[model samples]
Target: MDKAKVLETRRLLAFIAVFEEGSFTAAAARMGMAQPALSIAISKLEAQLGTPLLIREPRGVKATAAGLLLSQRAYEIIGLIESTVEEVATVEQHPTGEVAIGLPSSTAAVLAIPLVERLAKTYPGIRLRLVESFSGYLWDWLLNGHIDIAVVFNQASRPEIISTPFAWEKMHLIGKALPGEANAPIEAGQLTGLPMVMPSRKQSFRDTIEHHIQKQGGTLDVQIEIDAGHQLIKLICSGRFYSILSPGSVAHEISTGQLQARPLAQPLERAICLAQRRLRHQATAVRCVTDELLSEARALIVAGVWDARIEAPLCT
Candidate 1:
């Protein structure tokens, strides 16, 4: 057989395993092969490809620069192969499969807890993988086929993804109730020059807030720009700095007296949107799970689980 033809799928898979597990011995155990046999196979693969794929280190083996590049391509190849197998198997079996959900860290903090629990109970066969990232990264991942779906705030310029409104929530200015400060609504301009902790400029919420401030003839003096919702809430509670967030995120803290939430004057609100790739194929189970999410979200809205002002935008 030709040398290239001798490079079997099994060898490629073994190479990938070693690249991931970082050791020939561990890869052998993972692949159910003797350590020496796995090492021989790796050697054969490197010889066939005419390149060293891994770098031996004292702690563990690391992929070489070439190896790292190959590993990325290997991942995509493996994913496509697995997806094909799963599609064929689904035709014979039921629509049970995995769904990878990408969410912003803030959305995951507020919504994923209950959503995951419900999904686990209702669809035990459907494996759900949640990736928490910022809106930009999540959007990129969604387009790149790294995730199956996402729940995020709608962006002004829509990407080439199919999106549906999942829920709506009012944005609130949360801060420690300062000594003797009136418990009344405060104007957005009043927050100007305050040492507020805000989300990074890339986040949709921060962009909207900044636009609103500028439109009202004021500028925000952001002392901190954090991406993690829990961290922001903790900072607010610790009296270090104040931040703005959707009411849904800070509801628990507000109810428990850990933090105080006030509606911004001339309030802003945004819709939570569910997004999936426009051209990618979605497994039936994933679609069903999304449907369940929408149903539960609607039920939460009806039961007043979300705050009252979150129903629609205060502006329109």
Candidate 2:
């Protein structure tokens, strides 16, 4: 870009913000800039271009035909600038800055610790923010830009969103084992007789488990509904009820004999995915965290720590 174009970049950015926000005052607030400064920049841009770019009104503002054209091109210009800055920052693409990851509470129980440990060792400069919530909330956060990456049981389809099939978190039937009855596989039909404490209908896992049970000519007789993952496990551990969950969720209890889990004879599994917005300028930190998640998941599968099939490699 020439010096004149470089000097006019700030005006284009202001105009872009104003055009998107539909009001000069709102755009100034978003940019943390003075309203008069943005107005001056937009005015200068219009003067140089010799066209009225915005139509100001009492309600707000609307983009003129010229303004709409500039807005479309400005997005491309800004995207390229951001990509260039990141490329010049690190030749080897060392990840820096913050990366946000959203996980379902149950999935986090098993995956979060190891993933965090690996990231801490591999990228000392990169920061990680972990958000645990239901899949629905996580999806909303991912779409709204509150989180950069998410591990969800269900994949989402949209123009702005993308998902990678990372692995499958195997769902197991959980109960307090009868004395001397080792953890072993159980026939799917037996699940219909067990009194169950389950995730609410809104939880995707519940849908997955129920669908599997129905396929087996049985139904989940959920006597109680618990929205929280840990509490659901605790309720099952109390010996009064049963619940189906990933073995990874109660790994410690299963290992130490406080609880027992059995895989269904007819297997049921939850698909685990890494989701992110399809950004024009992908961040190095996001890729670093994503790579670490896959690496840790693979190691866990190899070491028998997590009972999941490696469906896809990093970012696959």
Candidate 3:
């Protein structure tokens, strides 16, 4: 096969419609085209590839093995084209380009909405792409240029990355309140025997919690090491286990009495840092988002809702 040969977008779309609908007649109807025209398009595409892409059955059409491979590539190519067109059309007077940001799941719960709202109002032309994951993956994404910015935890300075201290967040022991239990702070030592569900070890937040637990001369009886944030919260809320998490992550549940959070008597705080690849060009759109992110985080801290202390101000 000639790798350099161009695959016409229209023909690819026609083939995809048939592949999904599984019948030329239905696909042509869905595409608002005649069945014969749709069949000709698919035939031309298969001829170009020099292989049979579809096998006609008594009931409908089924794709050959080669057809399956082309369908996957076709979707990707089409999606990229559509997104590129939309991005180009959005350019105007203000800074305009896609700015990809990475965030931990805990932080995303509190910050994603406000950040999107602020950018839409202040920099309407800027297209924001948010990626939610743990800090370790965020760091890797930043270095790999998969993301332009990331809100990470306790990151040290590296040659390829620049990190600025943004805030420090307090960790709390989250679980359902025991019968008639008071709302006082819980001792770190008490966690030694509790059934717990925690994030896996590679994550920075998990590492921070384990470090403090070991420091307090206690060990966590971890029942499950799950990375999915929502499910972990669910298990804790069901009164089956407890997990140490930042307040922002479980704020709604705590307010509704679905879960109760106790502050650690010996406080454990994690440094929240904003990081970027030092070598990546600081485009106007990216810089605008960076400033807005710092501003929004500062506001959250000052509002007294996020249970955090500002370590670096936006002006810095």
Top-TM-score structure, candidate number: 2
Candidate 3 lDDT tens digits, 1-316: 4564558888887887787678999899878999999989888888888999999999999889898888767766765665455446654556787889998888888888999999999999789999998788888888665898999888986534678788988888888863224567777788888999998887866877887888888778999998777888899989999999998888778878898888887888888999975433245677789999999988987997677888643341
Best by lDDT: 3
**Native-referenced Cα lDDT, model 2:** 0.78
Go through the candidates in order and give each one's C-alpha lDDT: 0.71, 0.78, 0.81
Which candidate, 1 or 3, would have the higher lDDT against the true structure? 3
RMSD of 2: 6.4
Better model by TM-score: candidate 1 vs candidate 2: 2
lDDT of 2 by residue, 1-316 (tens): 4545633668877887787578888899988999999999988888878889999999899988887777766756765666567768876857678888988877787788988888899998888899987777788787666888888876855434677777886678788863224656777677777899987877766787788789888887889997777788888889999888888878888888888887787876677878875553255667678778888888987898887888643352
TM-score computed on alpha carbons, candidate 1: 0.66
> lDDT tens string, model 1, 117-198?
8888887878888888877678778765688788777743232356776567767777777422544656867877667888
